[model samples]
Target chain A: MKANYGYMDGSGEYYITIDTDKCMECSEHFCVKACPAGLFRIIEDDYEDMVAEIIPNKRQAIKYDCAPCKPLEDRPELPCMAACTPQAIEHSW
Target chain B: MVTIGIDVGAKNAKILILKDGEILISKYRESGFDQAGVTTALLDETLAELKLTRDDITSICSTGAGRKAVTFANEVVTEVSATSRATFEMYPEVRTVIDVGAEEGRAIRCGERGKVEDFAINEKCAAGSGAFTEAMARALELTVEELGKISLDSSASVPMNAQCAVFAESEVISLLHANTAKQDIAKAIHDAIASRIVSMTRRVGLNKPIALVGGMARNVGFVHSLNAAIEDEVLIPDSPEMTAAYGAALIAAERAA
Candidate 1:
């Protein structure tokens, strides 16, 4: 759970967010690989076709509604930060 | 040559002592909380029970989430490699391996020699992992062990869409309120997870003669759903739970030779 570096938000708080456009463009699903909680998956149709959509499958709707970075303990470790090849994920306050 | 494989899993630690192709001894114990401490204790106790010492083990390997933390291991191997090796050893015809443990689910393709060709793992969310099922079991006031047996008897089937474990629990509650049979609900949970896992397995290309390993592999109901989803008979070893440890042992033996 412990790692180096962090992100900052405009409010002077450190945070990380996923840019959907970058995520869609990225070919490698590194986020899926880096995640410890098994929260992200590439959607597939009934015909068993791998789709390009990437979704965060959280425990509850309310949990998803909360800001992307609620709390370290409340959310799965952000694999997107490590997965982003283009550095599309920004950890800022 | 004597070899040993230790699987320091999140919930349990297991040791397998082997000589050539024969299993000398195997032991599994609940890993209360500490990974390193519990693994050390388990290894010590198991070695003592077998009247063997650390030096008696020519090579040592570790597998599972806490593999890296096992200081006793000479080499740390990925679960994908270990699972495929173990599955291939158990069923030489097995070309695919599906592992569902407490925290992750993985599907691996093996080469003719049992080397990992390609693999996919679900380590990000609980929806497709055993933790989701455990959570659902807790909410239903049933032990996780009861779910598989109970689910096997259900005639009716329900559909659950929530891919998130927490959301899935809520869905199960709603279904229970509607007088849904527990078996039906359990079956739905297995089905939902199977669909997700099958999708990943298909992504990696599911060949025939698949082997299911890991703790969740013990769930007969889930195995049925997995088989049905993939449209193939999922091969499960008699000691499905020990596959990972066995795989580690296999690796240790090879290293020693």
Candidate 2:
């Protein structure tokens, strides 16, 4: 039997999953480089607006969201799946 | 049996002539809006060199980044169809095919009998592509061929941020200013590009016996880093860039048969 897979034309079914805990302190964010679809981008979320960055000796940092290399139907076979060195990124089936 | 295939891509064109499971002639050329004229010229040139007429060709098929552009061809197939067909023909054991070009890159999964079962493509960016590599090489005052050779010599890893080619160029310039080693920078770029390809390939679910094709496949550094990143040996065709065209020709032959 032939197995059916892959995204239909102009539509895709893969979603990028990030283990935020693994990404919190990682430096070599290769996910930003590996997605040929231009799906991964470094967007620094402002914690000050959401919460606050200043508090004596508090380890406060903003969140970085790694998205699909491009926008498609719901999602894409995310190019970030294998790029994360810490195994922090995944693709939802 | 004779068959012809044409691949009209964003940055280039490829033509192939095959007979009885053998490639007789192949040509690669740059493509433009006037694809018909360009294809005619290339065909005439190749036919003249091979001492054959267009009538000698029994069937025609087209594929590539611009498969739909070959209006004069007998049939136009998806690059996925043609890539899987051609890759399986050359290496029947191949389960994965990675095609990287000037404009985009793709990962394909093929099953038995050379059928494409799953695939992923990146059509949006110049980053992690042949064109981006070429542009970076020019910025570094190096040729694409020399870049790979020198990149392999690096002893350290230089960090590069920026997924866009434009931003990557800025990052490269900054790295130069920061006195980062050139070889290290080169290796870093390869690593960066490898990161993207690995991500895409993983989406398609990398299995064993991966084959790489397209113009960027000619880069030894890419091959090395890609192999290292994935920890799998890569299979590249004798003429790695022409695999897509050959696949198109194979489809033409199949249809004729």
Measured against the true chain A, the candidates' chain A TM-scores are 0.42, 0.46
lDDT of 1 by residue, B1-257 (tens): 88888888767888888888899888888876788888898888988988988888789899888898799799789878888898888889888788988888888888886898887776757766889889989878888878877888889878786766777789889998999999989888888778777766764567787788888988877888888887878888878878989998998888778
Q: What are the models' TM-scores?
A: 0.74, 0.76
What's the lDDT for all of these models? 0.74, 0.74
The residue-by-residue lDDT of candidate 2 on B1-257, one tens digit each, is 88898988888899999989899989888888877788888888998999988788888898876776677689789888888998998899988899998887888989997898888876666765787788789879899988898998999987776666787888898888998888888898888888778777766667887899888888988888999988987888888778888889999988888
Candidate 1 regions with alpha-carbon error over 4 angstroms: A1-93
Stretches off by above 4 angstroms in model 2 are A1-93
Error of 1 at B32 (Å): 3.6
Q: Write the per-residue lDDT of candidate 2 for residues A1-93, one digit (tens) a residue.
A: 111112222223433445555555566767766755344454343431111111221111001122223332345544565666767655434
Minimal lDDT window, size 10, model 1 chain B: B196-205
State the DockQ, from 0 to 1, for candidate 2. 0.07
Q: List TM-scores of chain B, every candidate.
A: 0.96, 0.96
lDDT of 2 at B225: 91
Model 2 TM? 0.76
